[model samples]
Target: MTVSGAARGMLRTEVDRSLKTFLDHQRAVGGGPDVVPLFDAAEDFLAGGKRLRPAFCYWGWKAGGGGDDPAVFTAAASLELLQASALVHDDLMDNSDLRRGMPAAHRRFQALHEKEGWNGSAEQFGAGAAVLLGNLLLLWSSEMWRTCGLPAEALAAAQPAHDHMRTELMCGQYLDLLEQAHGENTFESALRVALYKSGRYSVERPLRLGLTLATRGAPPWTDALCSDYGTGVGIAFQLRDDVLGVFGDPSQTGKPAGDDLREGKRTMLIARTLAAAPPEAAAVVRRLLGDPALGAEGVATLRTIIQESGALAACEEMIKQYLHDALEALERAPITTEARTALADLAVAATTRDT
Candidate 1:
């Protein structure tokens, strides 16, 4: 493997190990039978993710002159829990049925309720369980970060960025809900949602956290570099998700084709399509967008509209432009050559279909 590839592999392995250890500790602490299912759900949801956030944090630490240390890996791995927390809540908010080709947390609980012939509404039970599960993951993420055995001083330095990441993500989630409810989505509004909802937490703040941890007295220039490069990569990452929601392989993406259309995401990709499409085509999109029982025929029609309208190509170009900007920021970053290569690889992974 190349250096970057090896680093990613190591990150995947170490983060997985750290998460396993933490979850195991939780299990050993003992919970009631009712909560066992929640624990099981947490374990299932936490397993086998891409671990993208932690990788960015790890590479950020490397860039800041931090040495190889498993404690840093443990600390970085906490990001996986935070990410899982966000996704669980996001899936519930979107009413998504599946996650990674398995039933979503809410759906899983709904099934359990139905199986048990519970008295309350299965849907309500599922929704409530999902909310609690998401909260559980968030709590676990905080605990993991605190007990990662890092120096108190170092953790203290990174705490502000960590707090900002959590706070910004919640604000972003609120913005997403507001956008969906109002149903008046401009490209600019969609971009703001993307940046606040996914961008800062996914890449920017994680990088900032790592940088701060490594350089307790980090320079202003380093912070600027993290913002510029990380924001570009983060926004491009969400844009890639926009494309995947429409055109991705079900097996690869762990969701049905055109699920985003069914969910009425109102992504920038869709906004751009509407901007460039003919009046009739735009009307067709408006007519078909958000049908809960959207069929393959509907999906195909929307796909044709997106492609023929040049929205897909336009989104692709935007991703390229953002990636180009992110990489250019790297040119001015004062980091090791290896760190640069790893961060570049990560940026590409964030933007491309492959990861």
Candidate 2:
């Protein structure tokens, strides 16, 4: 099988195993009846993601010469749990109604509130419940990590990196929120958000954590290779996401087309469009930026404007550049042939995924 195909298979198997473990844990604990809903919500949230983070961690470990230890699997699963926490909170923050073709966590809670005839505002109830559930997932992720049986020194080495990932993600989120509210965002600022938020957790830190655990001794140049690879691929992933947000089929994406436009995401593509559009067209783009009230027709027009402005081409070029850089970094790193091939495939798949 091809690398992409193999990665997909591995990802599916890991996700299934991890989810079973999660559910079994919940059952063993006999979570309070009131918190049954929370568990249900978490299960639903975990149902349909791509499981990219765990796959990265797994591949990173294998590349670092780690065997198929149960502890590695547990550590990888913890990354997915961390991802769940991030998504739950992100959906609430973005006020997204749908995720992976299902109602978002908050939306699910809102629907239950209405169905149960609860005497409270569904919006408030949903948001509050989702927040608590996200917190629960965060705690669960930490517990998973702690119980993974890694060496004490390895665990200690990873703590600061893990904490930094969370802090940087939160900061990036805040920057994103601030940019949305201000309506005046620069390409540099948007790129910073991408690096700090998605780059570290999505690629760099996870790879580092896995490699650190796998290699009993910390090797020089490991950090540099991870940084080079992570920054490149992480940005490429986000660029692809921006393209999908605007142009992807709603059925495949599991979200409304142009949702990013509606949310006024300060993506590199949008920044390029703003810079390249004709004066009149640029004005229209600026005016519509982050306007939640923009109807479908307006969105269509805006998309057209973006495409015609040459911004799409620019974004595509950037994606290619990042992919090249990632491959170069991989070449420079001293890793096993199988591991290098897997990472290369992942890089291609990440940039080219339709959903």
Candidate 3:
């Protein structure tokens, strides 16, 4: 493989190893049979991902002229645990059955309850277990970050980004849940939710944290440029994800087709379709959007509405526009040539991915 490719592969291996080691230690030292499922769920769910957050963190550091250090890898890898915590809770909130082609953490726990002939409601037991498991992952992520052995200055500089990432993610999730409850389906609100929910955490904060570590403190201009680049790219990533949610190939996406529709996701695509569609079409879409029993026919109907209403095209254009803006931000940033090039590539990968 090429040098950059090989380096990325090595980084993935190290990140996976670090996470596994941490989880393994926690599992070994923790409770009994009851806790095993929690640990098992985490390990299994964490086993697969694009490793986007870690890569962003690593490359952000490199862009700021940091070297390839193992300690940095450990710090970056910890973001995966935070991501896992988010996914577990998100799945529970959405009542999703599958994640990465496997049963969600709650579902796994629910199955365990059923098989073991445990008392009480299996669903409630599963949900409670999932919540605790998610909390544990969040706790572990914080512990790993705090104990990464970075110098005091670097840790302090990076801590705000870490704090903001978690806080914003939680707030975004709350807003999402609230939006669904109130049935507030506006294009502007959908974009706002996407920004806070996925955009900031996925790219901006991780990049900022890495840059903070690399520089020991980020200069104002450096922070601003990374912010612009990361936010633009992150929004594009979320937009692509929204499109994929409704129309993507199930095998590639690792979820059933129309999962988002069934879950009643108030996405930008849905917003746009509602705005652009005829009243009758919009009404039909609204009826089918969140039905738990949304079948293939319902999915196909909504897909048709989205596509025919020009919403999908509009969303695609938005992705391209955001990606263009992200690259432009990169061009304006003062960073290492190699790192800039890699980040540019990452922007494309994040936005254009099928999964």
Candidate 4:
């Protein structure tokens, strides 16, 4: 394996070990029978992720001259809990049925209700259980961070960024919900949602938090450079998701084709299509955009309109630009060469992947 690949493997192993240990400890000592399913759901949900956030954290620490340490891995893995919480809540909000190719947490709970012939509305019970489970994961995110054995000073430095990340993530989510509700399809608005909802939390905060934990006093230039890199890559990551939502193969993405259309996400692609297409064509798009009953034929028609309107090309160009800017920031970063190369590889992967 390449250096970055090996490091990633090691980090993944460490994170899995630490999470299992912590969850097992929780299972052994905490909660009643009602909460056991919550713990099980968390473990299962956490087991299948790509661990990208933790990888970013680990590489950020290395860039800040951190040593090879298991403690950093444990600390980095805490981000997974935060991600799990966000996804569970996001799935609920989107009313999505699947995650990572499995029934989403809420749907799983709903199924459990049906299997056991439990009384009460199955959907409501599932939603309530999922919400509580999401809450549990959020709480555990902080708990894991605090117990990761980092020095008090390090935790103190990292706390502000950590806190800001959580707040910003929720605010972004609110923006997304607001846009969906209002059917706001403006490109600028979509960009704003992407920035707040996924970009900062996914890239900037993780890098900042890692730097704060790994070093007592990084130079201002280094911090700024990391921020620039993170922002560019993070935005690119979201834009890529927008593309994948529409065009990605279901086998790779683990979601049906045109899932975003069904969800009525006002992504930049849709915005651009609306702006560039003829009025009648745009009307067709707007009409069919959010229908949950939209079938494969509808998806194909919309995809053709988006493609012929040049919106897909436009979004792809923007992704390339942001990725270029991110790599440029890496070029000027004052980190070690190994760290720089790894980060650049990660940034590229973030932008240029099918899943």
Mark the regions of model 1 whose C-alpha exceeds 4 Å error after superposition: 1-4
TM-score of each: 0.97, 0.95, 0.97, 0.97
The residue-by-residue lDDT of candidate 2 on 50-162, one tens digit each, is: 77777777788888888877677777778877888988898888888888888989999999999999997999999999999899888888888877777777678777777
TM-score of predicted structure 2: 0.95
Model 4: per-residue Cα lDDT at residue 215: 83
Model 4: per-residue Cα lDDT over 241-327, one tens digit each: 999999999889888889899889889999999999999999999899988888999999999999999999999999999999988
Error of 2 at 106 (Å): 0.9
> Any runs in candidate 4 off by more than 4 Å, and if so which?
1-4
Per-residue lDDT for 97 in model 2?
82
How high is the CA lDDT of each candidate model?
0.90, 0.82, 0.89, 0.89
Per-residue CA lDDT of model 3 for 1-355, tens digit only, reads 1237777788799899888878878878888886676788888888999999998998888887788677888899899999999999999999999888898889989999999998999999999999998998899999988887677788898898899899999999998898788764887898888899999899988888888899988788677767789999999999999999999998998889999999889999989999999999999988888899999999999999999999999999999999998899898888878888888878888999999
Task: Kindly list the per-residue Cα lDDT of model 1 for residues 166-220, writing each as its tens digit.
Answer: 9999999999888767766899999999999998899999898888889976798
Candidate 3: lDDT over CA atoms? 0.89
The pairs that clash in candidate 1 are none
RMSD of 2: 1.7
